[model samples]
Target chain A: MNLGILIAGLLTLAIYSFLYKDNPVYRAAESLLIGLSIGYTLVLFWQSTLFDKLFYPLLREHGIWLTIPLILGLMMFSRLTRKWSWLSRIPIALMIGAGAGAAIPAMLYARTLKQVSATVHPLIMENGGFDISAVVVVIGVLTTLAYFYFTREHKGVMGKMARVGTYFLMIFFGATFGYTVMSRLSTLIGRIDFLLGDFLHLLK
Target chain B: MNSNKTRWIIYSTLLIVVVLSYLLGINLITHPSPEVQKSYTFIENLPESSVVMVSFDHEASSLPEIQPISLILLRHLFRRNLRVVGLSLFAEGTAIGYRTLTKVAQEYGKQYGHDYVFLGFKPQHISAILGMGESIRGVFPEDYFGNKIEEIPLMRKIRNYDDILVVISIADGDRTMQWIEYAGAKYHQRIMAGLTAAMITTYDPYLASGQLSSAVGGLKGAAEYENLYGRRGMGNRGMVAQTAAHIFIIVLIVIGNILYFKNRSKGGGNR
Candidate 1:
């Protein structure tokens, strides 16, 4: 008899009760889930980041290099006061600047350059066979780009290309929508299995 | 019937069908996708004792889909005698990654520090990813259990991405994309992903570009890997109920379209 399984099963029922109609029990469970998640995250960050990274190095190891980050971190608390609220922006600016600096080039390379390289494949395979899928992808890419082109009025050939682009977009959205349904159903199936197999012992 | 009552009927019927399907134990036969096979094959052919980094790049909500995928990946890595450096970009994944790693390791009689080490969660994920391209121990100075990174035998050997063979991200969201951008693109480290079904399409561009070496996606991905691994697990167990629910939803959709057209024809404005 696992107390954990029992408690989890009841909470699961509480959550699913909303489908029947919302009630006090469902709200309580929802609140509990959110509160516990935040509490758990706070404890985790306190231990992993604040204590381990900041206080430990500052106090025990006598590491002086970490002081810069420590001060920046402490300065963030200025946001609590009306007068010093502007002071908090210094740290935020630094964080944003650093993050963007490190991320932008990498993002551009991966999201754009590599994608373009992949798109520019020869219409013929190395084996000298025609690449039908390559042709479809090329058309898909051109048409999709045409849909997003705002400078040109969508008339004549542009209109047709944009219309084709819409079909590709719909195909993507449909595939994504189907997968989303499957993913949600997977979660549902998991909870049902837990309730029946673990808590009720109804399944072997 | 009132709309509310009809809604209730649909819900009740779906639930009853799922329960019945569960009792009847109707499972769909699952096969590994080409992407899953590619990931498996890549991991299988790695030289013995190569180091691999696996990031539990998901929150706790998606654990049902993710757990089986993570379990199977770790199982295969352990079997291949690869040293795994486990960590999580998501805070919830710290305990989750450690728990999964320990479970799989125990099954293979593997030691914690010798066979694997969980480097724990790192805040500021992109920074952590880039920093790990330089130094893993620098990024995560301590393990999940608060042991110094220097103390772990596995951590001592794996200084950065260069020392690691590949990075596997078990993700339910865009963290895998960040990995592809920062870790794989910037450092040229190989990447594979285990994703929720919904995220499969999101990563298609990356997969097509070979930015992701391969991806195993969702509960079906789990079932497929289980089949490949020659062991049935939760992924298989959930399939019957999923199939039952899917059929019910389809039936509802069909009935909905019928009622919609009929109402429109009668000038009831799609009642």
Candidate 2:
């Protein structure tokens, strides 16, 4: 009954029509979504990031120290001009350098060292029994690590371990794929619910 | 039948089944998974009036999956009488987070400025995270509504991560990882995540290392939390359709694999 619901329902149907074949309706809806997304993102960026963090402080609070980053940020717009395009690299390089410098120690501790520590748990469980999952994890991690050890040839024992690693890797990939499918399906279900329940009001 | 025709048949069948499941009110009983239980218990046992910072770190595109998690967790946090400080690190999530927080807070009749406040979105995520560790007001001079931070009664008591008991990042991506790396590791703030299912595996290592206190992942995770919270909401309703769809897909996969192997055998060595 609502005009908004009718419009949304028509757009939903238009988008779904793409599964049958591409057409102008679908194309229009797609373009509309893209345009709206860009507009929304631009407004949000200006309000949340540029205006709040940069312009406000610089103007209101006498944040003279903020000018350096502001200039560097403006330099990034040099890419729009062919004559000064090289200026863009300065900001890009600074971003990459700062990102790497900040990420290295964190990644080493969080991603690498912590992960390695988790995998190297004692073979025995806290309850004084054999930890099957722990053993499997240790084997899977070592063998998987061995499979990636391309510096040496995989022969005999190494070859066997690598094959075992392949199986573990396959299992991991399968589980990941399953989870990915579930995630996508959840999104699909959400769209369907919007179409049926919200727009059509066919279900409560 | 051709593959394209077969695909349409499968798609139509799935749509019909899922729709019927929803219409007929086929609710699936969900057992709380260990991870969801861990998250629920952690929040359940928190002392009253303890401050919990919730970061809405997702976009509208993932809202269908992410919204339920955020809603249920917000409900739990509110029900516990915990002071909530909501913020967003992602630009697109700012309005969405604001809406969700406002809605849930109203359900509990929570007063703004005293019970909760939204700090709005900030860019340069790493800087925002580190800044909060030092001083939350220094990072966000004004709340999302442009009210000065010092004027908000809630913000007055909350200065840094030390003032908060926990930080929960509801995210569809690796922004949660940044929370863990910066907030959890450096500042020793307890961190939890409500993540999209696709990101669950990526954060399992952090969960194992106890870096993340707990994680509630995907729709199923939401459903479990809903059960634990004793309220049947969107999550419980969605699970019926999810289960039916999962079964249908598995059946289709098996049939497709069988057909492929059968055709391969008939072709023999020529193929």
lDDT of 2 by residue, A74-187 (tens): 999999999999999999999999899878887788777877887888988789999898888889988998999999899999999999999988987888888888888788
Best by DockQ: 1
- Candidate 1, residue A48: Cα displacement in angstroms equals 1.1
Q: Provide the fnat value for model 2, as a fraction from 0 to 1.
A: 0.55
Which whole-number lDDT from 0 to 100 does residue A73 have in model 1?
88
Candidate 1: list runs displaced more than 4 Å. none
Model 1: number of backbone collisions: 0
**Once model 2 is optimally superposed onto the true structure by TM-score, how far is the C-alpha of residue A127 displaced, in angstroms?**
3.7
Docking class of 2: medium
lDDT of 1 by residue, A2-75 (tens): 88888998999999999978899999999999998899889988888889888988999998989999989889
Candidate 2 segments exceeding 4 Å error? A1-6, B268-271
**For this target, which candidate reaches the highest TM-score against the unseen true structure?**
1
List model 1 lDDT by residue over B80-104, tens digit each.
Answer: 9998989898988878888899999
DockQ of each: 0.79, 0.68
